[model samples]
Target: MTSGSEFPFSPDPVLSGTSDDRQHALQLNPQQLLDRIPVTIWQANDQGQIISLSARWQLITGRAPVDSLGEEFWNSVLLEDRDLSLQQWINACQQQRPFVLHLHLCSIRGNSCPFLIQSEPLLNDTDQLIGWVGTLQSTDVVIPLQSKWDYTQKFLQALLDNLSNGIVACDTQGVLTLFNSSAKKLHGLPLCPIPADEWASYYHLYQADGTTPLPQAEIPLYRALQGESVHNAEIVVKPSQGKPRTILASGDPIIAQDGQKLGAVVAIQDITLRKQAELELRKSEERWQLALQGTGDGLFDWNIVTNEVFMSPQLKQTLGYADHEVDNNFEGWRQLVHPDDLGEVAAAIEAHLRQSMPLYVAEYRMRCKDGSYKWNLARGQTKWDDNGQPIRMIGSHQDITRRKQAEMELARLNRDLEARVTSRTTQLEVAKNQKEALVVKEQEARRQSEVDRAGIKLYESIISNIQLGILVWHSQNLESVDHLELVSTNPAAESILKMNLHVEIGRQMSDIFPSFVGKHPDILLSLVEIIRTQQPRSIENVPYTFPEGDENLFSLRAFPLPEDCVGVAFENVTCKETNEPAFS
Candidate 1:
C-alpha cells in the first residue's frame, strides 16, 4: 500500500543541470540539505518511536531536536489532537501505507500552529516494515500551483482567529468585510449587515466614559475608513450578556499603491483590568488628600543625606508666606523656630535617627512671617539606608497655638488661686470659732424645750388617770342655770358617776345634778359662794339622794378655775362611818 512519491524520497539528486549547480549541489551534505529545506523531515522506527529530526524543526517550533527524539515527540503534540493523530499513524504503519494529517503542533512559546504531516513506511525487500519517514510543513506555506489562493485564505483566517487582540475591517463603501473571532467575543455578537450609522449601537460600542454612546463618526473603524489614522483611542463595550470591558483601539486607512482607498482595519486590546487598577489608585490618593486636609496638618519630607527639605503648601500658608517665599531647607526652617526650642527639636530628631527611637516628636514655638510666635507640634519617622544610616524623614506639622495658650493661662490662674486661699485663712478661722459658740447655745435651748414638753405630758397623764370623779363646769355669769353647761369629764369621773358623761357634755350642770337644788340645798349655796369668791370649797359626807332614786353619801370638793369655770372632784363615801366628823 506504500505510495511511490510521498516523502522518503528514493533518488532525486541532480548533477547534470549546470557546472555551478553540479558543484554547489555536490558540496551540500545531508544535514546541510535538510537544514536548507523549508519543510522538516523526521523519521520513526516501525514501532512509532521518533528516531531523527531535522534542524528546521527547532527553527519553527522553538524546541530542540534532541528533546523531541524518541517517543517524546508525541508529547509535543497538543493534547486535543495527539490521540487522533497517533491512531491514524498507527493504522498507516499496520497497513504499511502512506499517511497524512492536518493537526496543531504546540511550540515552546505557548502557541499552537497548524501543520500538514505526511508519512510513508519503509519496507525491506521481503516487504517487512523497517521504519517510517515524514515531512512536516506549516499550513501558512504557499503550495506551488492551483490551490495556492485557497490555502492562503485559510492560513490568514487561522492566523486571525489565534490572535488575542480583536480585529475589525471595513471596505471603502463602509461595509464591514471582516470581524475576527476575538472581535465577536469582545462585542458579544457576530457581524451585522447594518449601515455605518448603526455600527456603534449594533456592536454595543460606547465612549470612554462608558455611559455615552459612541458617535458613528467617532468609531475607530469608521474614522479609519474616512482616511483618518486613529491611535490608542479608548472605547467601552457593554455587552448585553456580560460585564462591560474597556478596549484601546488603533487603526489606519488601507490605501492602495495608486492612492486609491481600498479599506480600513483596526486592532483593539482589552484594557479593563488596567483601567480598574488606575481608578482604584486615583480614589486611594483622593482619600489620603482628604485625610490630610481634615486633620489640618501639613506634610514635610526631609532628605537628610542631601540636606534638602520639602514642605507642603498648607505649612507655608500657616506661616503667612507665599509658596516661593520660604527657602526649603533645614536651616531655613530652623530660623523660623523660636531661638529657645531649636536645641530640643534637633535633639529629638537626632535621638530618633541615631538611637533608633520609635518616633521623633517635638513641640515648640515657631515665628511666623508677621513676627508673631505660634506653637507647633512636629512629628516624623525616618527611613534608613542598607547600612542603617538615616537617609530621609517624612512627617506632618500641626498648629497647636490655641492649646498652648490655654495651658499657660490655666497655670497662671492656679498660682493666683493659691495666694488668695492663703490670705483668707485667718478670716475663715474666726468665723469657724463664732459658729461653734452659736451651735452650743442652740443645743442648750433645744434640750430645755424638750424637758418642758416632757413635764407637761406627764402632768396631763396624771390628771387623765386620777380615780377621783372630776367634772369641769362653765358659766357665762353664774347667773342662771340656762346660761351654764357641762363642759368635759374624765373616764374616772364617768366610772364614779356610774354614767356616760360624754353624751351629757353640753347639758346644763343644774340639769345634770338636780341634787344642787333639792337634796342638800346647802350644796347649791356652797356652789354659788364658790362661784362668787374664786376660792376652793369642800363638803364632807353630806347625804345626797336623788335623781335615780338611790341614796348615797359622798365627800365632794370644788376648785375654782380660770375661764369662769370650776372643777369639782367627788369620792364615793357611802361605805364610810357617818358618826365621825367627816371634815377635819
Candidate 2:
C-alpha cells in the first residue's frame, strides 16, 4: 500500500454556512485541518489493512507513514499486550457495525499514551459494506473536552439552585435527577433517592390543609411525569424542622419530538402570606357588615374613575327607594338632586376632590322616590392617588327636612313680625303727619313762617325714611338730543342702586342705569313719557343687572313732577317672586 492511495473518499470540505463550524475551521485547508486536530483519521480496506492515513497520524505516533501501511499500521500503534478492545474491534468489523474502543498506543520514541478509537463501516451506494473509516483521539485531548462539558453542566446546576422558586425534575424512570436549593429549603431535607411510591412520605408532602398526608398519585410532580400538565396544584409542606408552608405548584411533562416521555419538571411558589391576607380580609368584611347594621346613617361609596357607586341599604331606604329603584352610578345620584340646589352641591364636591377643602359638606334637597323632595345634609371625604387625582369617595347622608321646615317657619314668622311692625310704624307716621298738618292748619292763622318750616320737615322725613327708592329726574333737551338728568335721590335709592347719590347727583339718568338701556329701554322711555305727558306710569318686575353683576327685579312707578322733572319710585320684588312654588 502507498501513502497516497487513490480512495473513493472525497476531499474534506472547508466548513461553511454555520458560524460555529466556520469558527472552528480557522481558514485551514483539508490536510492542514486534519493535522491540527488532536486525532488521526485513517481508512482501511475490506481485509482490515490500512490503505491511507492522514498526515497527522505520523505526528501522533512519531513514525513514518509509508512504513505503517497495511497491517503494520495497526501493529505499530497497538500495544504489544493484546487487549479486549482489540477483540471488540475485530468482532465489530466482522459484524460490519460501529464500535468504540479504548487502547494504548506506543510511539517510536517508546512513549505510551491511552486513546479512544471509534470506527464505523463504510457503505457503498447499494448499502454493501465497502471499507472502514475511523478516528483515534488521544486521552489528553478527550479529557480536556470532557472537563469543559462537566463545567458547563455545573454552571447550569448552580444557576437553577439559586432561583427563588423551587424546581424539581425527574427522569422517565421516576428517578429524581435534579432537586435545587429552593426545593431543599421547602422540604427541609436534601434530595431523597427513594422510589416514587415513597416520595410523599420521604418529602413530607401533604394536602393543601397541611394536616392530611398527600397520596403519591396526587403529587403534582408525579402526575406530570405521567404525561399530564398540572397547573396551580396547591400543596402543603410540613417539614420536620419548619412550620407548614402553602405552595402553588405548576408542572409539565418533558416529551421528545416522537412523543416519548423523557422526564417531568415542576415549579413551586410559596403562597402562605397571600392566604393569610385573604383570611384577614374575610374577617374584616364581617366586622364592616356589623358596623353598617349598627349605624342607621345612609352610606355611599363611590369609585370616581369608574363612576360606580355602592349604595347601602340604609341609603336606599332614606331616599324611599327599593333595592332596584335607583341605578348605582354617579349620574343616577346627580339626577336625583333638586335642580335649585344642584349647583351648590356640585361646587362643594369639586372643592373637596381638588383638595381645596378638608371635607365636602353641603345642604341640599334630593328628590325622593315618591316624587317629593327632602333636605339632605351630605358630608364626604375624597381619597387621592399618588398623583393627587381623586380615586374614591365615601359619604354619609342625613335627613334634615324636618329641621329645614322648622327654619323656614321661623323665617316666615320673622317676616310676618317685620311686616306687622312696618304697618304699625306707617300708621304712627300717618297719625303724626295728620297731627302736624292740623297744627300747621291751626297755626297758619297766627304764624305763617312756622307752618312753612313744619311742612318742609314732614316732606323730608317721608322721603328719607320710605323703603321705596325715589329718584327725581329733570328732562333736558341738550342740542336737540333728549336725555334725563338725575337731580335728587333719597337714601333708599342710593342704597338700593349701590351708588353714592351725592357723587352722582348731576350725572345723566342714562349713565346712572347704563346696564338697563339695552336690556330694558322701556324703563327709561316710560320715565320720559311720564315727563312729557305729566301722567303716572307703572312698570312691574323689571329685571335689572348692576355694574357689579348683582341682579334684581324692581317694580317702578314714574310720575310727572313740576319743573320738567319726573319722580320715580321703585321696590325690589325679587325675593317674593323667587319664593313662589312652581305649578309645573
Candidate 3:
C-alpha cells in the first residue's frame, strides 16, 4: 500500500454477484514452480501494501524481495513513476477491476529495468474485499523496442532446426555458446569451454589427410571471425570420445551494423562415408575413363618426383590419334602445344607450382593430328607436401575453340570501330578549315570598305579648303601639242571661269576653256609648254573670251606634276591689275 494513497476500491465489482467476481482455486506448488516462473508475482494485503513477491524479483531487479516489502516497494519504483503506479493501483482497487501499467524498477546496483505491472483485487468467501494479486513481468516498454533483434533471434533458431549441417556459434569473447543437435552429433560431444586460441588443440582437428595438424589460421571458425566465408573446406576430427571423422566445414561471420565483428557461425558436415566411397571409386580405371567420357574431357596426371606423366586414352583420342601413337613423356605435350601458347602455358603452370596462384588454369591452343590447332581450357590442382612443394598434379582439358573464335571476331570489330572514328575526325578537320577560309575573305572585304570611306573623306576636305580654281589635265598625245584633256575640276574652277560646267567633270580642256574659235591658243600653248618642260609657266593679263562673246582679263598658270599630268590655277584679277608683267 502507498503510505499516502487516497482512493478506495469500489464495492460493485468486488461483490460475488457478477462474472468479474467468479473465482476458482487450483493446486499450485509455489516453491517448485512459482520461483522458476519467468515473471515476478506479488500479493498485496487488503490495505494495498505488498506482502509477497516471486524470487525473480531478486534476479531482475537486483534486490531481495524482503527489501521491497510493503510501501517500501514503492520506494524501489523510480521516483517519476511511483505516484502514477500508486494512483493506478488505487483506482483499480476502487473500481474493483484489473489494471495494467508499466513501471521502472530501480535496482540496488543503481540500474533500472522496465516491468509490465498487472493487478487484480482478491476477495474472501463472505464477498468481502481481500488483498490484491499482481505480477511484474520484465518488459521493453521503457526502452527502445528491438523488433529486428527479436526477429533475428527467431530466424536463427528456425534455421538451426531445419538445416542439415551441424552449426556452432560463439560469442564475441570466443566462448562456444550455441551447439545445435547436428553439431553435437557431428562432433560426437559438446565442446568443453576453452579459449579461442586453444580450440584446435581441444577439438583435435587435422587436415583432410588426417595426420597433419590443422593450423589455427586455416580453421573455418577463425577465418569467419576475420570476415570471410569459407566453403567446403575438408578436415578430419579425431576426438578422444569418438572414432576419427572427416567433415566438410563452411563458416561465416556475424557482424554488427557498425562493422563490428560480433561472432562466428560454422557449419559442419560429416563427409567420412563420402570420402571413403570416392577412394574406392578411384581404384577402377575403367570407371574413371567412363566418367571422363561422360563429361567429354581428357585427363592427365603428373608425378613430379619421378618425372613420369600419364595421359588418359581420351586425351589421345581428342587429337585424332590412335593408342600408342603419341609419346608418353611431358615433352610430347610441349611439342603439341601451339608455339604462341607455349610461353603463356608454361608461365601459368610455374605460377601455380611457385604458390603464386591457387590453381593452374589456362586457355591455349594445341596442335592436332591434322596439323591444325584447337583451343582448350586446362585446369589443375596440385597435391603439396608439408613444405608446400608439389608432389603430384592432376588436370583436365576442355575444348574451347568456339569461345576463342568469338573473341577474335570481337577484336576485329573493335579495330573497325577505331578506323571509322579516325575517318570521321579527319572529315571534321577539313570542314573546319573551309569555314576558317570563308571568315578570312569576309574580313578582307570589310577592311577594303574602310579604306574607301577614308579616301572619300580626305578628297572632300581638300576641295572645300582650296580658294583658287583647280583644274587637273592630262596629255592625250606624247609628241603633239594642243592635246590637253581635262580630267577633274573643282566648283571654284567652274564658277571662276564662268563655264557653269556642273555636269561636265570629264570634258576635254578644249571643250571647257575659251578658245575664241581657235583664236585663244595661249591656254593650250601654256599646257603644252608645262607638259614638255615639266615646269611652271605664268601668263598675266591673259585675254580670254567666253562662248557668250564677253571678254575677260585673267591671270593663268600651269604646273607640271609627275606621270605627264598638269594642274592649272587661274584667277579673274581685272580689278587688282597693277600692270604686273607676265612671262611664260
Candidate 4:
C-alpha cells in the first residue's frame, strides 16, 4: 500500500501527540542520559526520515546531524551492496526485530571504516511501531557478499573480497580481470571494466619516495607482465580521487598447466601508516643532528658489517664518563645499563636487525657515575642496502628520569583517589539500605509512636548513614525561611561544628556554622535562594570556621528536598584537591 508497507515494522511515525498524552512528554530527560551512552545511537521514523541521532555520529563520521538524514546516511554504503542492505533493513522492519550486520561507514577522509550496526524497532505505549533506534560499533568482521549468483563464483569472489590485501589478475595480453574490492579501493578506480595500464596515468602512480612519477612499464602490473616476481616493491599509490597510500606489492606470473603464459596477479598490502612513521623517524634524526650543538641528547652510529661504533662526546658525558673513557662496541654501552635491562635492550636491537620491527626503541635504567640508576630512552633506525641487507644503524638517547618518576607519582595518586572513592561508595550503599529499612520500621512505628517521633526517626536514619555533613532546614510561608533554626543535623554535620547533632539541631544557622553568618554570609541565604529557584547550587573551596577555632576548606551545595525543605551538603576538601564535585 505504501513504500515501506512491505515491512509492517518500518513505520513512518506520524509526529502527533494527544492532549491526554502529557505523561509521555514529561516521561524522562532522555538527552541527559542518552548522550553519555558509548555507542552511536540513531532514530529513524517509519517513513524513513531521521528523527534523532547521537552527537557521537558527528564525532566519528564527521557528518553533522542536520546533513546526515534518512537515506543520505545509508547512501555512503558501497554502491554494489546498497540495494541488498536496503532489503535487509526492510526485512528487519517487517519483522519488528533487532538486526545486526557488518558494514562500512564512509569516514570524513572519504575512506570506508568497517563497523557493526545493531538496530531495533522503537514502539509506543499501544504497541504501535513508531520508528527505530540503533547503535554503530567498529567491527573487524568483513561483510561478505550475501547473494552469490553461482556457487563457484560466489565462493571465489567472497574469498577474494574478504582478504585484507588487494588481489588483481590480468590476462597475458594485460587485459584487466580478477580485480577484487581491495584492489579497486587501493587503486581508487571506477567500477567500470578497464585496464590498469590505460588508467595508470589517471591514478597518479608514484615511485616509492612519493615524488617521482612511475612510468607505465615500470608499474607493478606491467612489471608482472614481464614475468618478474617482485617482492616488497614499495610503490606509493597517490590516486587523484583518494588519499595517498603506500603499498608493498608482490606479484607472480600465472603459469598454465602446459607452461603457457597466462597473465599475472599481484597482492598489495597498504603500509601507509608504517611508511609515514619511518619517514617521521628519518626527519627527526635530521633535526636531532642539526640541534646537537644545543640539545643534551647523545648520538651514536654503528656500522653493522664492520662491527664498528662511533659515539658523540655527549654520549659519554651522559654516563658521567670522561670523553673517550668508554670504548666503542656493545660492551661500551652494555656495562652502563642495569643488569636486568641489558638483555632486553640487546634483544630489541637484534629484533630490529631481523626486520621483525620497523625500528628499535626501548627505555631502561642506566647506571649513572654516582652509582644511581637513571631512566634513558633509546631509539635506533637502520639503513638497508639495495639487496635488502642491513648495512648501518644510528639513533639517539635521552635522559627521561624525571618523566618516569612523574608517571609513577601520578599512578600512586590515582590509586589513593580510587581508595577514597571506594570508601565513599560503601557509605552511599549503607545509606540506601538504611532508607529501605526505615520505610519498613516507620510503617510499624506509626502504630506505636506519635507523628513527631516517626518523623524524627526518619530524619535520624538518613543522618546516621551519610558521609557528607548534611544540614536540613525548614521553609517558612515567605517561600523562604525566616526561621534560621537547624531542623536536623547528621553526625558528620555536627562534627564539622565540633559538637553533636542534638546540640546543633534547633539552633540558629549562624550559631552552628560560622561560615553561614557575618557580613559576607549568604551562604545559608544562597542555599535558601537556590531552593526557591528549584535549582541546585554549589560553591567550592570556601573557608569554614568551627567552634574549636579551626579553619578548614569546604565545598557546599544546597538543593530542595521533598516538601518545602532545603538540604545543604558540606564536603570537606583539602587545598590539594583538584576535582570539583558535581551537584544534582
lDDT of 4 by residue, 1-584 (tens): 11222222332222246854445445534453344456676777865455566667776678776566777777766665565455556545666766665556777777777677888777789988888777776664333542342477788999999998999886555555577889889988843334545646666778887889888777777788789988888888888787899998899888999998777888999999887887897876544443353334677888788877767678778778876787787667778889999889989988998899999999899887788988877888999987989988988776667656655555554565566665677665555565455555545444333453444345445444766787777665435444566776677876665666786677766666545477336576776776578677788777766666677787777776544567778877855446656333
Q: Between candidates 2 and 4, which one is better according to lDDT?
A: 2
Clashes of each: 0, 0, 6, 3
Judging by TM-score, tell me the better candidate of 1 and 2. Answer: 2
Each candidate's TM vs. the true structure? 0.33, 0.41, 0.29, 0.32
Provide the lDDT at 484 for model 3. Answer: 67
lDDT of 2 by residue, 1-584 (tens): 12676545544665545887877676555656655555678778876667777766777677776777875766755554333344445545776777666667886467877678788788988998889988887886767676676689899999998999999987655656678999999889886544577789888899988889999999999999988899999999998898888999999999999997777999999898889977996775544543454355677788899999877777788889986888899988889899988888889988899899999889899888889998877878898877999988888776667656656655564565567666687566655565565555544433543353455455445544767788878878622224788887788988888878878888886677666776776677777777678788777777888777888888777777666777778877788746432111
The C-alpha local distance difference test score for the whole of candidate 4 amounts to 0.69
| Candidate 2 deviation (Cα RMSD) | 32.4
lDDT of candidates 1 onward, in order = 0.75, 0.75, 0.71, 0.69
Candidate 1's residue-wise lDDT over 508-536, tens digit each?
76677765555565665566567779888
Off by over 4 Å in 3: 1-155, 191-193, 286-584
Ranking by TM-score: 2, 1, 4, 3
Which regions of candidate 2 fall more than 4 Å away from where they truly are? 1-144, 257-259, 300-310, 324-367, 371-395, 400-584
Better of 1 and 3 by TM-score: 1
User: How does candidate 2 fare on TM-score?
Assistant: 0.41
